[model samples]
Target: MDARFLGIPELVEVPDVAVVVDVMRAFTVAAWAFAQGAERIVLAGSPDEALALKARHPGAVALKDGAPAPGFDAVNSPGRLRSVDLGGRTVVQKTTAGTVGALAVKEASLVLCAGFVVAEATARLLRTRGCDGVTFVVTGEDGQADEDLACAQYIARRAAGTETDPAGYLHRAGASRAAAELTQGVRQGVHPDDVALCLELDRFPFALVAAVEEGLMVLRPHAVPSPIEGPSPIDGRPL
Candidate 1:
């Protein structure tokens, strides 16, 4: 169970048992929607596509999308979704990061949806499954900064049976200094709170495990191992 950090595109060659992450929004928002009792989530790569899916499944669900281009229900914002009610309905989400990364990893043996919000459950799933050659692909705007790196470091430490003082890795990864100027950093400008959210171990129990059906990324909540714990030296973060 060897683990090392690789840039997003660098993941292509590795055998992927990936837990795709986009904590700032995307995946994090999905976790929230699931927490609110959404039955399933479909990760659409673009806003237009998500709307189309919603149109096809109207009255039974809600659809949302966000893109720099106008006309989306809303941009990917967890804060925006916090007050919404999604009881018993599925959600279709389209974002630039989470869904795209999930789709790219469709080639992997096991692709589980992950975010800072559910870091604990994710790591628990990985340890329970005993994954080999795991890859964490960060889908930046064009693939850059990728807060998934924080979640990955958390998982990498656990997979190898080691401990990582995140402050230490943040220093090593130079995220500390970068944090100062991060109001304008990589992968479409991720904020400091994004880092905090992505690393909150065991905050939720949502994992979007899925595959590309036909051409769309379809997701289902993965079964998480029981009694998830906080960051641990033995089990680490998931996937």
Candidate 2:
């Protein structure tokens, strides 16, 4: 299996499998929402589109970040989403980085939204599906985003049959400028617990796969066991 990494803007051509990562914290929020029992998530390119999707779907909830759209149900933060009951409800998500990056890769046959929360499951699913090649798309700043880059590298290492420890990569991401800004509470609408939530490695045992259905990028979780021997430990808890 071969793996290549690129930023969203660098994606001139995408491979069979595309793993788009947004660790701080779009994909993380999506993973948490799925863990909270969301039925499905629709990725929108803009806030207007997300609102429209929610309106069309009736029960769908819209989530977004930056310059709060009047119709959005809430901000895209895993910390805040943890308390909301999304059980069996569809989510319409429009983020500045994550969703846009996933939609940009129009050439990829398969698109997966990834973050630390679902990194291991994503790698295991890729292996199980016998994908010959994979592309990791870092969605922040066309690849300059440290947190996203670190996540892409971690997933790449795991997919390559390496028994890697996530601490090192997590540390790198934690020290990034984005993390620092979020830590200092400078980013508006981002919850204080969002950084910690986003950094939880392998917290979910499912891969969030995106497929183009009816001209929309719809994401759904697929369960996949860890590639490693035992359940991966997270914050003294077994996943």
Task: Please provide, for model 1 over 69-184, each residue's C-alpha lDDT reduced to its tens digit, 9 standing for 90 to 100.
Answer: 33344445555565677777768777756787787777777887776567656676677778766777755544455355766677666656566565554343235332333335
lDDT of 2 by residue, 90-115 (tens): 99998889998999885578888899
Please name the candidate that would achieve the greatest TM-score relative to the true structure: 2
In lDDT terms, how accurate is model 2? 0.85
Off by over 4 Å in 2: 227-239
Sequence-dependent TM-score of model 2: 0.92
Clashes of each: 6, 0
Clashing pairs in 2: none
**Over the full model, what C-alpha lDDT does candidate 1 score relative to the true structure?**
0.61
